[model samples]
Target chain A: MKRWIPFILTLALLVPIGAEAAIVVVVNNANPTEKMSERELIDMYMGRNLYFANGQLALRLDHSPKSSVRRDFYRQLVGKTVAQVNAYWARLLFTGTAAPPHVIPDKSEVIEAVKKNVNAIGYIDEADLVEDLKVVGRID
Target chain B: MFSSIHTPLRWLICGSCLVLMAWFISPGLVNAQVINDNDFKVSGFLTLGATRGGDEFLGFRRFVSQEGVFEDEWSYKTDSVIGVQFDKKFTSNWAATVQLVGRERIKNSFKESIDWAFLKYRINPNLTARAGRIGMSIYMLSDYRNVGFAYLWARPPTDFYSLIAFDYYDGADIVFNAPLGSGTFKAKFLVGSSENKFRFNDSAAEFKLNNMFGASLLWENQTWRFRYGFLSFDFDDSINQVLGTDLVADAFELADAFGWDGADNTADDIRAEGESALYHALGFVYEKLPWTIQGEISYLDTDYDVIKSNITRYISVGYIFDEITVYGMLGKGSQTSSRTKLPDLPDSLSSIPLAVQLRDGAQLLYNASYADQESIAAGARWDLRYDIALKMQLDHIRVEENGTVYWASDTLPDKDRAINIVSINLNYIF
Candidate 1:
């Protein structure tokens, strides 16, 4: 029984960490753009850039604020916690200078939204990726 | 008698109506439209704050006084505010926005004021233009000054912000954004005019600035941002009437006795007229995970002698821990007048009794420009919920030379003194 304690504790901690590693940024399979650098991603997400490299108006998607995947994605992409990003967006949103991305309920909805729109971009767990969505970038 | 209570109560009723309207529409509106795909979006923010201080601060009467004595009390009308914003996108290239904000003020009733009403047209992927009432970009946070939840401080430093009496201008602006190196560079050019009413004591004065123009440049990356701004305007204060004051009459009487042009000595002469004033500001922000640092320096100079030239600067540093952020700020400011002694009086009339009174009054006016202040503040912000934050702050301010910058009752002394203020606020957004 004592030997089982360590195994259970290790599994409990590693499970969440392993789950977090599966997050990836996804785009429509038809998007001519193959990949994007971290700088471009940050600029697009922060509202500094409104268009993709190909000059198409970019439509960014965000998961629900309560989702753990949404929190992890921002932390990995911009080194900002969920609260910090929210505060940052609040400033821009209230000023009419910029607007945050449209929020969908879960990873599957995000995938569906991205699949339907060529200019759309979203992030989801690696396990949620389907055939219609292309993995443009992976969150480390 | 009815003015004070009526304004606040009316504001409360208006606020209730807005709350009810938003509550009734949110569920249906949100479900039917995705934010990015929708043609219309509605959003709002509110901040409820209470401030207490050892002495009168920031034009707010902090205490009651009898005749020439002051007593300590709490003032709650200093920083409470509510605002709502609406945006409607007509097409991919065109959009319209309006924001209304309500707050307590000494002169205007608590009616919601239109902070911004503008139409935006996207010229290209890299260029855009907005026309209507837009906020002046003189300071780093000027775009979001009233959005308390966006910043780490409970309030911006009063000494610096109080210098500018106007916030919005009726004009147009164009913004250009480009990728520079590994960062983004943005340039904005704006031209417009503004008219504002400012209150001192119980009297309000109207100030107009015409042909107002400014430009701002910003460079930012993931961890750092740098901003520089310059603005110049043709100022006109000709219609400023000093209500409930006899100073103007006294000055005229003294001027007549000297057989000199009293017009030059009258209060009207002090009006800014078509004079020009220039303002320049530089600011930077650096943030990396748990640590953040930001600072700004600004200077203002006017062609008129009566208006004092001033310089102000502040630096703030903070550390973030999960949902809580703690910050400290240090600031200093000074104002100096150009005219040391009123245009040298004629030697022939120097001996007149009126000459002495005139000289004293002029001296009083010159002395009023003397201000040297320093302040230190510490504050903490706690994210209480998804969209709500609670903040508390304490400030220690020292008036090193004169207290002309701050609002104080007649009974309060104007000499060097230190004041302590405590403030708490709840900020939220929807």
Candidate 2:
């Protein structure tokens, strides 16, 4: 029973860590690209560069502004908080310079959108990722 | 009575049309998914603000009882404005955009003014050509100067931006965007002419700029950006009869009496006609997470003797803490006006009646040139909500020489003065 207690405590600690490790960036299975650098992701998401590595027009999708996943994704990918990202977008939008990514309601919709559109790219929890989507990048 | 009613009715119809269009487009926009592939998109920003000063500053009157007079008190119309924009994509490579802005200026009520109306043709992904009424890209923030939400300050430092008040020109431009190393490089060339009607000292004047041309280059990386721009324009203030009216006529009449060969031509030469100017600006911005620094310097050289050459610069630094940001800015402007020495009025002409008046007129012209001023500002911005921000700022301004920059009344003291201004604003975007 003493040995079992140690193993159970370790398992409990690893569960949340494992869950956090599941955050990843995903693209359509048909995209043909296997991976993306962090800089490329930042450019597309921030409306700086609109073309993907393959010269294909890129479409960006986001989790809802209120989502914890969205906040975590931006923090990991761009080192900006959700509020900072929102403020940045406000500058672009009000200037008629660029538009932000279309926000989806949940991780499921993000997955569905990316799966159906070859140009679409999104971020989701690895646990929610399916075989139909290609994992292009992973949040460290 | 009919004429007054007619004008208001026309404005009402225009206002209603804009509201209806916004209503129809807001839903599709709010439902982000519904407008992902739509043909039309609508967006806008609004800023409501109140400001007060310990002394008269920046032409903001403390009360409506006087015009162009400096007063010390609170005012609401200084920084409040609203803007709306609509974009429509007709084809893969064709698009059109229209933007309207309303603000309290020389008028009492909000008057809808077209800020930009342009048609765009995308020759390729990297290049675009646009024609119509386009925002002048002379300065770093010129394109979005009125959009308070886009900037960190309740207002851009007026010391430098107020040098040229025209924001748009009727003409065409071409923009090129290309990838350079890990960064992006953008170049824009514009050619346009602008006409402006402005009120100075309760007197209105019309200014027409001809053959205006400008070019700008910007290179931006993940953490840093550098920009350089140049502009040249031919200025004509011939229609501004108010300029030197009381003195110019007397000077010319005196010249004719003295049998000066170019008596009539002298007024034209000194009247700011066919005057030309060259402007150059260099600016940079560095942003890395919680730290931001931005600075710009500009130089203007003009042939108009009454309008002295000037140099202006400002630097701003800020730190972002979660949803709050605190910043400080320092700015300075200097003008070099060469005092007209009256060309050593001949001893024989010293006895003449009009000769003395002409010399006095020239002195007034030199005095009307811009003054040397310095400003320091500290401000904080808080993101109150996803689309709303609250900002409060305090500024201390000192005029070193002539204090003509703030459009003070003739009755106000023209010598050096110091003023403090406190402003608060709510900026929102949708």
Candidate 3:
């Protein structure tokens, strides 16, 4: 009875909040490269691996700070918390080491940042990719 | 010998002109995109911390002297520190930075200070040059000794960092960075000399101090980095010369009191002298995936006229999870010098046959040696919130040396052999 009650409650809670779901991923409309493996994509976004599949410098873009999309992006791609990422950068920056990639504020901001730069790539909700923005691949 | 005066006035004037040029050229000239938006501004950071040695002697050793004296009770104060760094980015190609640090009295009562300044001129996207006061890059973690956030713990291994206190020199560095297929490459070449005053020990008739000149090369690629450097210093005649004379006179007095055959003569002939130091250091770091490890080995060869050489090595390892990291470290070493005397002989017996002298002293006089000290530290870092972390560390240290004890009845109390320290800190960076 208790399990049934919790299951019913969960359904009740989720049914009304049928929020939009988005498959976020990066894409290149003009480049010859067609697809990226999950590892390659995660490497590019997490600031760990910087080179593209073709060995070219991969310029990356991001959702704005504190954005839900950004949080989801990292949770799905980096598998680490914001605090861990901050600590990672702390270790890197203070050691006279490398700095992380530049951060753009929002989906629109990222879309604009990536659109203007040829080597750029970033994530946004699947629904957000209109006719202008191309969909290279879906995450998961 | 320290009073070498140069054209300080000329340097100051040149600095003023550079500032004026920066102000006059609003940067719309080079990139045209950069403006005096005041949005582009400079920020700085500073920190101050102090510690009191425990009732039992605590803290850094008296390095100037080779002798170890345990203080019954001593309250120590250090500038601990206050510093300011001004960071300016004029264009995508030009950036300038200035750092000034004030240290507490290094000498008995005189303060010490160093001005660390740099002007970085970016050549292309992968290379740059920096000129000004630059500290040597010993370890990847050694360069930013002041920027506390670099490490997960309160401090990096103190044994290595503390041994060669001054790591920076005034010079120019050329740094290059490039990306390999899956990793990044970083290289730095630096050369410079130090213009500063440092104090080592408080006792000893043969104290040593010197001015240092050196160069270091560092290379880092993704998960691994290596550093190798050589440094040489010219030491001036020591303040111990007078102390050595006094010891000789005292020896003569003691020999007469002891009714020794050479009652009229003293062992002043055995007074050991001081010498300069030339040293080399090699360090390595590997951080791939969830594990990070760092190790450094250094060899310090003092021209102490006599005795065997001294070499020290330090190693540490760390592992990181989402927000927590645990680390362990081990450091053990010793310094050997003929000047070190055995402690057992009467204060008057300044010299004797080497074999007899070795037995008479309780690791005192020319047995002038530091206990082979060893320590094992384990610590964890917890990130409680954004920008702040709570850290707790425990360290157990062991010191091997000859010390004294008062006979209470017939029982022997274990003198100073083991020490335990626990520290908790909240660190934050903005």
Whole-model Cα lDDT of every candidate shown, in order: 0.73, 0.72, 0.51
Kindly list the interface RMSD, in angstroms, of each predicted candidate in the order they appear: 3.1, 3.2, 7.3
lDDT of 1 by residue, A65-93 (tens): 77899888888888888888888998788
Summarize candidate 2's per-residue lDDT along B160-199 as a digit string, tens digits: 7766666778899998988788788989999998765555
Relative to the real complex, the DockQ score for model 2 comes to: 0.38
Considering TM-score, where higher is better, how would the candidates rank from best to worst?
Answer: 1, 2, 3
Candidate 1 local lDDT, B39-145, one digit each (tens):
57777777787777655423332211001112265545555667778888888889999888776544444322787899999998788999999878878887677
Greater-TM-score candidate between 2 and 3 = 2
Q: What's the i-RMS for candidate 3 in angstroms? A: 7.3
Number of the top candidate by TM-score? 1
Each candidate: RMSD to true structure?
4.2, 4.5, 9.8
What's the true lDDT of residue B107 in model 1? 46
- For model 3, the docking class works out as incorrect
Winning model by lDDT: 1
Interface DockQ of each model: 0.48, 0.38, 0.17
